[model samples]
Target: MPTVLDRLNLALHYAMETDERVTMLGEDILDPYGGAFKVTRGLSTKFPKRVLTTPISEAAIVGVANGMALRGLRPVVEIMFGDFVTLIADQLVNHSSKFRWMYNDQVRVPVVVRTPMGGRRGYGPTHSQSLEKLFLGVPGLKVVAPNALGDPAELLAAAIADDDPVLFVEHKLLYARPLLEPGKGDLIDFQVEQTGGAYPAFTLRPADSARLTIACYGYNFELARAAALDLLMEHEIFVEIVLFSQLSPFDLAPLFSSLVRTRKLLTVEEGTLSLGWGAEVAARAVERMDGLRVRRVAALDLPVANAKSLEDAILPSVQDIVNAALSLVS
Candidate 1:
């Protein structure tokens, strides 16, 4: 029963052990401290030569990783905090992502940038944000966020092995949570199934037909799932939940199939509201399904406050999903 952080560390360990080309670099990722979240714990102890501790510069770290990737190496970088991902935008979006296509498929950049996102422990505005949306539409970059319902280790391995550059996002809150093992056993009242893909999308289905389908990613699913279960028990309102691991190359098949059963959908995310993940999902869904009712629950367009109470009020919550589901269904 390993935590999400444990699984991620295992994946890194396996990748480095099996693939001589794989290397990891970040700040404060050495012995004792390991990493800010300890995902790199024992990695340096195992592979001291490959595990590098650099200065506190996101741009420099990504630049180094990008170069290493181009010259026959697979580098997995840690941003320390997800917010600093912006500093690496130029090297990542322009250089690392574009090289393969720009070279007319002559080469591949197999680099994975891992970072923790979302707000729950009050890291404040800059430190606690879901900025994946900013990198979503980039031509050659792939955005991935693993959830509690699938094998994050497998997905991380896939990302490391792939020929393209991937931005691996981890919800900070998810590090300590245990992931539900796929196909081992079903939940008490819900049937959980995952789509077979490099990065899987898990669907949690209730016994009866659903009035609404709630689609979310990362830590937001935790809140959404609780709200869905509450709606079913307290109000007898069945809501199907679809949780996705890959965000950029978002697979709408699972969601579309759910919509076929439940005509309505409520997209929830921890990211800010206007022009965000929810908006894109809702728009793409409408293009495929006719008369498909949709609603989005997301954080307000304001910086996450440092205070716990203020942060909780600003970010999306279980109550918000419950209210949104009720409104969409009725």
Candidate 2:
């Protein structure tokens, strides 16, 4: 019954309680302020020694967490906004991600880099951007984005316990929303539609037919699910949706299996189109699956505008998914 944000807070509480080595680092993530979205509220008070506040430097915050993790602590770091991830790219990619392999498995960087992405609240171009796609290419980091149906708490717990570093992406708009069924009402109690193995991708098939498939993750998945339902109800087009809880080490099995029936794929994400994460999914699909058609719906290559109108125009929407799927079907 908890919201995605609620689940995330529970995950942190659970991690700290279960493991003495679990620590949290971020700016103003203390009581009252909680965090930019209050996801880390009260943790500092609960676990005073483990939950430490940091300066305004994102790079320093990550560097400190990396050092702590290298010393055998499970560090959960919160980057205030997704856009700020660029500031810590060097530490995250070059250092945290490489330490395990570089040390020949003698060391483990079990760090969970948590950050909020997307822009429905119109925080302007700098604060609101879905740049998760940028980290998808990093060799050792695992990219994870939990949808409404999936439990962010469970995923975060898994990420915290992981031996390698994890990029846990949370969308801004999804914080307050209740975890509802893909196309169902808010009253519907949240349930994980599909339990994923290896790569943890949840599949939701509203009906038996898979005329088209929509593969997406993060908060934007609500838009994709709504469009899928509209297509199913009005146009009688059944679309199977796969929401990924884990982005890296992406297992193409579920997608390829769905493609066997659908034959058409429409990948969606909030990140910009140029070399976006969807592009990688499409490329891999074609490389393995023969006679498959793939289309992608993503944000335009421009700074996300602050105004609601401009933001809607720039980002992916329900109409965008519908149009892309219609094109694939036609």
* TM-score to true structure, per model: 0.97, 0.95
lDDT tens per residue, model 2, 279-324:
9999998998888998999999999999999999999899999999
lDDT of the structure predicted as candidate 1: 0.90
lDDT of 2: 0.85
Evaluate residue 271 in candidate 2 and report its C-alpha lDDT on the 0 to 100 scale: 89
- Model 2 CA RMSD to the hidden true structure, in angstroms: 2.2
lDDT of each: 0.90, 0.85
Model 2: residues with Cα > 4 Å off, grouped in runs: 181-195
| Model 2 pairs in collision | none
Q: Write the per-residue lDDT of candidate 1 for residues 1-330, one digit (tens) a residue.
A: 888998999999999999989999999999889999999999899999999999988998998988899899999999999999889999888898999999999988999999999888978999999888899888899999988778789989999998899999999999998987644433566788778978888888888988999999988878887898789888999888999988986668999999999999899998899889889899999999999999999999999999999999999888889998889988
Best by TM-score: 1
- Candidate with maximal lDDT: 1
